[model samples]
Target: MTETITRPLSTEEVSEATGIPAGTLRYMRHCGTGPRSYRLGRSVRYDTSDVAAWLAAQKAATARGGDAA
Candidate 1:
């Protein structure tokens, strides 16, 4: 059996993908209002799937007349 490994994304990379600033990502993390993240050593990282899931959840919430982000 073989296993595939994926490197976690940093704040800057996630910001580039989502158009949210790095600082805002950090703030959202602090407020517990954003996508899930894990502490890798002293750096924070986000899983790509988690980011996608969070975006989908936000979109669904907005469609239901709720605020996203």
Candidate 2:
């Protein structure tokens, strides 16, 4: 089986995919509360897998009888 390559997403792409506003996404980054991101020289990129993992973690946290606050 051939391995699939996942492309990194731009901030706008990530915001579109997650239904989050671009400004909110930028604020999250500034607050360091968003999914892990990387800086490529001057461009910012988010991994789809990282976003999915963050969602799973949020679900698990909520499932543990704790409020995300």
Candidate 3:
């Protein structure tokens, strides 16, 4: 059996997909509030599926009237 590998997305790509600025993404990294990230040395990368899951979770929270506070 063979496992398929998916390329990890750069911050710029994620920014384009999520409309989140790179700086804010960096802040989220620092605060651990955003999607899960993989730190490969100095490079930060995200899995698209993880980002999608996080976005779905955020939407569900909003639908439940949960605040970031």
User: Number of the top candidate by lDDT?
Assistant: 1
Q: Which stretches of candidate 3 lie over 4 Å from their true place?
A: 64-69
Per-model TM against the reference: 0.83, 0.76, 0.81
Candidate 1 has an lDDT of 0.92
Candidates 2 and 3: which is better by lDDT? 3
Candidate 3: TM-score? 0.81
lDDT of 3 at 30: 90
Number of clashes in every candidate structure? 0, 0, 0
TM-score sort, best first: 1, 3, 2
- Model 2 gets an lDDT of 0.87
Over 18-43, each residue of candidate 3 has an lDDT whose tens digit, in order, gives 99999999899899999999987888
Backbone clash pairs in model 1 (N, Cα, C under 3 Å; residues 3+ apart or in different chains), count: 0
Candidate 1 per-residue lDDT, tens place, 1-69, comes to 996768899989999999999999999999999999999999999999899999999987777655569
lDDT of model 3 at position 22: 93
Clashing pairs for model 3 are none
